[model samples]
Every structure is written in C-alpha cells, then in structure tokens.
Target: MTINDIAARAGVSISAVSFALNGRKGVSDQTRARVLQVADEMGWAPSSAARSLAEAKTETFGLVLARDPHNLGVESFYMRFFAGLELEMSIRGYGLLLQVVPSVEAELAKLAKWRNSRSVDGIILVDLHVEDPRVALATQPGALPTVVVGDPSLAGGLTSVWTDDAESMRSAVRYLADLGHRRIARVAGLAALAHTSIRDAAFADETRALGIHGELVRTDYTPQQGAECTRAALTGAEPPTALIYDNDVMAMAGLTVAHELGLDVPGDLSMIAWDDSVLCEHTLPSLTALSHDVVAFGSHVARRLFAVVDGAEPGAFLDSTPSLRVRGSTGPLRG
Candidate 1:
C-alpha cells in the first residue's frame, strides 16, 4: 500500500496524508488520526528518509564507535550501556542509528552524511581521544545536537557525561596501598584513549603518595593483550604483589594467566579491575574492582542529549563517582 491508497481511503489529498504521517503541523488532529488509521489498515508504513525531509526532524540519533561488531562480544560495558540507551530512547520516541567505523575521519563522514541527508537530529559519540576532531565538529554552528561519553576535556559548547576515572583509579590504588601491597602493577587500556591516560596519571599519583613501587603497561583492551601483559608483569625480576586492570575482560585474562603461572590469587598476586562484569563473579576467585551503574551512565547521557535537542542551555558537564566493590580477588599482602 502507498500514501495514495491511504489518502483515498481517508478522503484527503496525498499531500495531507503525507503531512499527517510526517507529524507536520499542517494537518488537523482528526485528519491525522484518519490518515493514520487508513495507513495502518492498509499495512502501510512511511519512509523514514522521506518523512525526515518533509518534517525537518529525523527523530533519530547517530552513535559512532571505533570497533568491529565481533569485538563487542567481550566488551560487557558497551553492550550494557547500549542496552540502557536503547531502553530510554524507546520510551522517549527516538531511534538510534549505530555505526562502527575504523577511523575518526570515517566516523566524521558518517555524521556529515547523516546531517546533510537529514537522517539524524543529533548524535552521541563514544571512544573519544585527546583533542578529538569530533569534539570540534560537534560544537560547530548548525552541527547536529551532540552528547559525548568520554573525557570531559572537550571543546566548549558540547554536552558530555563521564565518570571520574582519575579519582576512581586513585581510590583503587589506595586500597591496595592500605592493604600493604608495595609492588602494584596496572594493566592499562589503549594508550591513545584519554580515559586510560587519566587512569595512568591517577595510579602514579596514588602510588607515590603511599611511597609504594608502581608499574603500568598498555594494551589494546583485549583479553589476549591483557593476558600477555599479565604474564610479563608476573615474570618480572620483582613481580607485582597486586595487579589492577582497566576492564573486566582484561582482568579475567589476567586471572587465567595467573593460574597458568601457578600463582595463587590474592595470595600470590592480588587483582583489581575496572568495570564490573559477570565473568568476574564466575572466576575461581571473584574479582574486586571499581564498579558503577554503566546502564545509568548511558541513560544519563541519552537524557542529556534529549535536553540539548530540546534547547536547554548546556551547563557544566556531568561526572559520576565510582565505588569500590570488594570481592575475592584481593587480600592482605603476604608479609
């Protein structure tokens, strides 16, 4: 069925049907309902692309990430965060257009295309870096309404929601220090990610404050990389008495590597991780780390995006504090 069929059944012109279906203001309430009923009866649906052009609002948001779809399997944080975003967006009557691109330029192209074609009303960006171009583009005049989900050190005029990653990292390191772990090692995420840099700085600060020896190693946020880094840290001349990892996936890998090396968790090398996941609970010794409601983070960011789209004055960017979750993976340092 077509718009022409619905127009004929509703006793209105095709243009009137189009206006009603697109949520444009030219149609009366009665006419809009009649058109909708006829369209529903005929099993007809309006084209989103066409409706966006006619209504001047796409009612969609673009989500750009820099990872392959298959890599999502191990990243529990993103899956859970996205699920929360989808849930909130469903209630708010907005659709998400998610795209994965290899480079920042590719992501920029996708956003530009969406803007030029009127395919999205706004956008939400993840996986940010220092001095990211997306930050500048998002703040440009007439650019799509944007909400970013990483470091808040962005160009002025954009809305951002993030956790206090540096503070949380310091807290984790202090916990180990208070437990009398002098030799602590950090398994960091990608070197280029601003979050990783923040964490690294915080780790260094806390270790120095406590007068403890510290080491940090960078990885690609993959379990394999985490395992490899864990092995190297364990086999060092003076191995770390405690290990802190950037994410739960890498923490699990560290646990596996520790077991292969015949080291007892907590007893031989204590472990802590960021971003709590189900895998942490199932490990031989449950992992302890900084934890927060990532779902809430995603929803909070989405709500902020909606506020921006609704023309709210962009105020200070929001940051959530992370709490420590104690589990079996850490213990009193062996004397």
Candidate 2:
C-alpha cells in the first residue's frame, strides 16, 4: 500500500498524508491521527531508502556491543538497561541499531559504517578502555555526536553519563571492614573496561587506608571464571575472610564455590555483589549487593544522547550512586 491509498482512506489529499507521515507541520493533529490509523490498517510501510531521502532522517540511534556475542552470555544488567533505552527511543519515535562485535576495532568499524551511511543520528558507546580511541574518533573535527556510557574520564570531551563507581567501591569496602573482614578478595571484571580500572583503584585506596588485606582477580564477567577465581582465593594459603564480586551472576557462582569448599556463607566467609538482580535474592543465604536502578541509568544515558543529537553542549553527567544493600550473605567475620 502507498500514501495514495492512505490518503484515499483518510479522505485527505496525498500531500496531507505525506505531511502526517513525515511529522511535518502542515497537517492538523486529528488529520495526522486519521492518516496514521488508515496507513496502519492498510499495512502501508514506507521504503527505508525513500523515507530517509524524503525526511532527511533515519530516525534511529546506534549502539555497538564490543564483545563476542556467544562469550558474553545472558547478562541481566544489560538486558534491563537495553530495555530502558528502547523505552525512551520508542517514546521519541526512534529505533536503536544494535550490533555485537568481537573486538574494540570491530565496534569502531561498525560506528564508522553507521556514520558514513547516515544510518543513525548519533551513537552510544559502551565498555570504554584506558585512553579509548573511540573518544578520539568522536571528538575529532566534524565528528559525529556521541554519548559514552562510562565514567567521565573516558569520554575525553564527549558527553558522558555515569555512576560514582569509585565512591561506590569505597562504600563496599567500608561495609565489609565494618563486619570485621580484614582479608577481602575481589572478583573483578575485564581489566580493559574503564569502570574496572576505577573500581580497582578505589579498592586499593580503601584497603590501604583501612589496613585490610585485599586481593583482586580479573575475569571476563563469566560465571565460570567467577567460580574459578573464588575457588583459588578460598583455597589459598591465606584465604580472604570476605569476597566481593563484580556482578550478580559471578557472586552467585562464588557462593557455590564457597559451598564446594565446605564453607558456610556469612559464617565462614562473607560475600558482596556489585549489581543486584533476582539472582542475588534467590541464591542460598542471599547476597549483599551494591544496588542501583540500571534501567533508570539507561534512560538517563538515552536522554543525554538525545540532547547531544539536538546539539547540546557536551559535558559530563553523573547518574545515581549505587547504595549498599545488606543481606544474609554477609556478616561479622568469625574467629
């Protein structure tokens, strides 16, 4: 079906249908609604190529997932965060062009393709590394507007939306210290991620100040790696009295590993998770977590991206700080 059919069904001129469909100012609100209803009912879909040319817009945003899709597995935090971003995009009559790539170079190539093809109005970047080249790419003269979903330090001069991860890490350490956990081990995520660096530095600072013995083991945010690291830490000559994990899945795996060692959670060992999900509560003895609304964080990022697309000044914006949630998985260190 075509706009001609929609115009006929809505009892309006072809130009009127065009105005309504393109969100132009020529049509009244009632007429626009009638045109859209008639078009939807008639199964009239515009050609993407034709629509882009006519409206000078794709009405889409771009996002690249920088990792092997199979290796990444199911992550509740990202799923929820993506849903939140979709919510905002849908309300604004936009779509997200998602692509998963195997490496940082591949992700950058995807962004470049989108920019060159005019497939997106702007891009949202994730998993920033130290001295991220993406920041340099987007900050160059006449570069595409970008919103970085990481700490402001990684964004260079581009717009950024982030939580206070350093502060949050400090809080987690202090919470365990208060429970008399002197030797604490952290199950950290990929070292390349800018957040991991922030958290690692914070962990070091806090442990040093509080006179706590701390060990950090890095992983690819996989449950298997989480389990492996947990077992190694607990079976060491000098085991940690408490443990902190980068995410809920890893934390749950750590719990199981503790059991495999015939240890009691919050009795022989204490554990904390960085992100809260249903998994945290469902685990035996539950998991103490540093909690924040990830969905809301995604929404905040979307809003910032929209502002950038609208030619707003690029700057850093801090989202909600994560709060410590006490649970049965943590307790006073036993003698």
Candidate 3:
C-alpha cells in the first residue's frame, strides 16, 4: 500500500507519515506509533528498491572465490561455511552476492566493480595470501567495508576472523609424536595461502623441537594431488609412520591410497585429516581429524562484517583453535 493511504487513514500529513515510516526526526513518537500501526493494519510494506535508493545501501554482502569451481563440490568446508553465512544474512533480510573467479586479479576487478557501483554494503575476503595485494586495495580510501577470513597479520588493518592454525598444527604434531610416531608427513594445501604457511612453520618447529622427522608435501587441496602425495610418501625409502592431510577430501584419498598399497590404517600408518566432516566418520576405518566448528567460524565472520558495516572500529577475532579428534585411523606406532 502507498504512504498516501496510510496518511489518509492515520489522519496525519503525508510528510508526517513519511517521517514516521522512515524513522526520521520530524515526527513525534505518538504520531510515529499511530502511523506505524495504521500502516501495519493496511498491510503496507516498504519497497526494497526505494529504500535502497533512499539509504544508499544495497542491503547485500559480496563474496568472491578465487579457486577452481570443481573444488567447491567436494569441499564440505565452503558448503558448511556458506550455510552459516546465509543463516546470518537471512535474519537481517539481506542477500549474499557470490562470484567465483579463476584468479586473484579477476577477484580484484570484481571487487572494484562492486565498490564503484555501490552494489553491496560489505564484502567477505577469504583464502588470504602471504603478500595479498587485495589487502592493500581493501585498505584504500572509499573501499568497501571488509571482513577478512585469515590471520590478523595478513589482514592489513581490516576486521578479521581467524582460527589459530599454527597452534592447531602444533597440537596435531604433538599428538602424533606422543603416539610414538617418530617420522611423520603432512599433505598440505596451497603453499600460497597464509594459513598453509603458518601451519607449515608450526609443523616444522614442533616436529624439530620433539626430535621427530617431519616431511611436507604441498597439494592443490584436490583428491588427485592428495593421493599422489600419499603414494610418493608411502613409497619413499624411509616412509613416515604417520600422515596428516590438509582437508577431508585429501585424507579420504589418502585412505584409498593406503588400501591400494595394502597398508593397514593405524596399524601400518596413522592418519589424521583437517576440517572433520561426515565423510570422516563413515570411512571404512573412521578417520581421525583436527575438528572445529567451521559453520560457526563462517557465522562469526559474517557478524564481524556486519559490525564493520555498522561503523565499528576494525578488530581481530579468534574464532577457535581446531582440536584433535582421535578415531580408528590413528594409533600408537607398531612395527
């Protein structure tokens, strides 16, 4: 219904009706309440387009993924994360504008376009790099409000929500060491991602400090790469007694590789996967994992972005450190 109808029924001036409807300062509280009640009675609803134009807000948030689209299907992390993000967005009657690009340059271009057009109220930045140019762009004057999902050090003054990847890596390494795994190997995700490097450093430091042999193999977070890495590590002259995978898909691939090689899980080689999921539990030998609430992590990032959009000072938030969950895939070393 039109504001004119509300003004006529409420016996108020059209301007008074406008002020009350928009919560502007011109109307008295009593008039505002009467106007609102009458409008509700008449089933009046604000036009989203008109409200957006009046407020200079699109009422939408943007997310850009610079990765292979195929990976999105198998990776449960992003699916769960999106579910959490949607949970927050739906409560506020907002929408998420998502775009997947092949490279960081394309992602940067898309962000610039969104900023120039005022198409989104804010943006969520993910998969942060060690020397991310996006951080510089995001910090520039007039850039869109941003919440980075990465280590604070890499966020470059933006509000950030990060998990303690380094500490989690150390904990996982120590867990395997305590189980008499003297030689261990890790199949890691992209080396360029900031979190991967942090985990790598922690893995190396913890393994050395404990006098354990540590090996690292880099992958693209794909099942194929995971299987290849697992095969190579297992075939080496001094194969590791324990292995860690960067993602559940990779860990599952490693399990298949172990089976192919006729190796008994937790008996011949111990294994642990990161980002625990339902797949981990249903495996032939249930997979041990470094588990955390990834969906909650996404929700926290959305909250931080909303805070930034509301003009709060940029800040860093630690979501949680992933804790080890022992299962059938890991055990004390037996030769």
**lDDT of all the models against the reference?**
0.81, 0.85, 0.88
Clashing pairs in 3: none
TM-score of each: 0.83, 0.85, 0.86
In candidate 3, what are the lDDT values of residues 256-277, reduced to their tens digit? 9999999999899999999999
The true-versus-predicted C-alpha distance at residue 326 of model 2, in Å, is: 0.9
lDDT of 1 by residue, 246-330 (tens): 8998999999999999999888889998888778888989999788888888888888877776556675465578878999999
lDDT at 191 for candidate 1?
Answer: 86
Which has the higher lDDT value, candidate number 1 or candidate number 2? 2
Model 3, runs deviating above 4 Å: 1-56
Query: Model 3 — TM-score against the truth?
Result: 0.86
Per-residue C-alpha lDDT of model 2 across residues 23-74, encoded as one tens digit per residue: 8897999999998898778876667325533423566788898886876654
Off by over 4 Å in 2: 1-23, 26-56
What clash pairs does model 2 have?
A: none
Better of 2 and 3 by lDDT: 3
Measured with C-alpha atoms, the lDDT of residue 48 in candidate 2 is 39
Rank candidates, lDDT, best first.
Answer: 3, 2, 1
Best-matching candidate per TM-score? 3
